[model samples]
Target: MASRRTALRPPLVSEPDLPDIVSPAAPRRSSDLRAAIIEVDGEADLAHSTLEQCVLSGSGSALDLDGATMMDVDVRDLRVAKVSARRSTLRRVRISGGRLGTLDLSDSGVHELELRDVRIDYLTLAGCKAVDVRVDSCRIAALDMPGATLSRVAFAATSSDEVDPRGMRAEHLDLRGLDALGFLDVTALRGATLTLRQVELLAPVFATAAGILISD
Candidate 1:
C-alpha cells in the first residue's frame, strides 16, 4: 500500500499551455524566461529556472538546455525519444514506467538521483557521479558503471539482472529482493562485498579466489 502523498499524481503541462521553446525575440537565457509552459522548434539555451509540468521539445530538440533544473518530470515516460540535458540536477526523478534502455550519463553530473517504479536496461554511468542515490521498486536489467561513484546509495525491492559492482563503491548497496546479477570485466568486483544470495550466486568465483574446490 502506497502513502497518500504519492497517490496524488500531478497533472502534466498541456501543449497549448506551454510557451514556445525558442523565439527570435525570446530571452537569451533560462533566467530570462518566466513562463511555466515553454515550446521550442530549434536549439535554445536554458540555464536556470523552475520548469514544472511543462513540455520542452523541438524538431531538432524542443530545447537545448545546458544547465537546467527539473523536478518530478515525466522523463521516464519519454522512453528512448526523450530530450537530452547536460550539467543538470534531478530529484525524485522516476524512470519506473519507462522501457529500460541505455541511460547516457557519461560526462554529466548530478547531486541526487532517484530511480523508482521504473524499468531500465543498459544504463551507462561511465563518468557520472552522485553523492546520494535511491533506487526502489525498479527493475534494472543491465547496469554498467565503469568509472562512476555511487556513495550513500539505497536500493530496495529492485531487480538487478546484470550488475558490474567493480570500481563502484557503495556504503550500502542494498539488494534484498534481487535474483541474479551478471559479472563482467571481472575487475569490477575486486573489492565489492555481497550478502548471502550474492555469495551463493557468485560462489564459484569466490571459491576460485580462495583456492578451494567444492565441485569437480
Candidate 2:
C-alpha cells in the first residue's frame, strides 16, 4: 500500500510589523530663565540662557557642550554656522526663526525640545534618544534620525524635503499636517499614525510592500 503525504500549513496569526509602544511622557515645565545676550563659546553649560532675537555664530562646533546640559533656554533667530553637540542634553528649549547650517545631536539625549518657525539646512539626531520633541511650523531641508529612539514626538504643520527615519524606534508619533515631498521610507513608519489623506497618498507604497498586484 502507498503512504499518503501530509501538506504544510500556513501560520494561523501573523505578527505585527510594529513594536508594542508604551505610554508617552507627561508634560513638564522648565524653570524660567532670565533674558540676556549670551554667546556660545568653548565647552559650557548653558542653563537658563534666554537669548531672544540674538545671533549665535560659530564655525565647526565652536561651542562644545562636552556632556553639559542646556535647560530652560529660548533662542530666536539663531545664526549658527555649525554646532556639534553629541554629548549634550537640551531640556525645555525652544528655538525659532533661524537658518541653521548644521545642528548635530547624534548620540545625545533631548527632552521637551521645541523647534518652531525655523529653517534648518541639515539636522541630524541619529542614534539619539528624545522625549517630547515637537517641530512645528518649520522648514527642514534634511532631517536625519536613523537608529534614533523617540517618545511623544510630534511634527505639526511642518515641511521637509528629506526626512530619513530608518531604523528608528518611536512611540506616539504624531505627523499630522506634515507636507513632505522627498523620499519617505514608509517601511520605517510601522508604528506611526497618519491621517486618511496620508493613507490615500501612500496606498501604492503600502500595496507594494504587501506584495499585492494592481492591474488596470
* Candidate with the greatest TM-score versus the true structure: 2
Superposed on all Cα atoms, the candidates' RMSDs to the truth, in angstroms, are 8.8, 13.9
Best by lDDT: 2
Model-by-model lDDT, in order? 0.51, 0.63
lDDT of 2 by residue, 43-130 (tens): 3333222222222322233444445456555555766666566767766667778667787889888887788898888889999998
User: Once all C-alphas are superposed, what RMSD does model 2 give against the true structure?
Assistant: 13.9
Error of 2 at 58 (Å): 8.7
Model 1's alpha-carbon lDDT is: 0.51
| Residue runs of model 1 more than 4 Å from their true location after superposition | 1-76, 81-88, 185-193, 209-216
Cα TM-score per model: 0.60, 0.71
Q: Which ten residues in a row have the lowest lDDT in candidate 2?
A: 8-17
**Candidate 2, clashing residue pairs?**
none
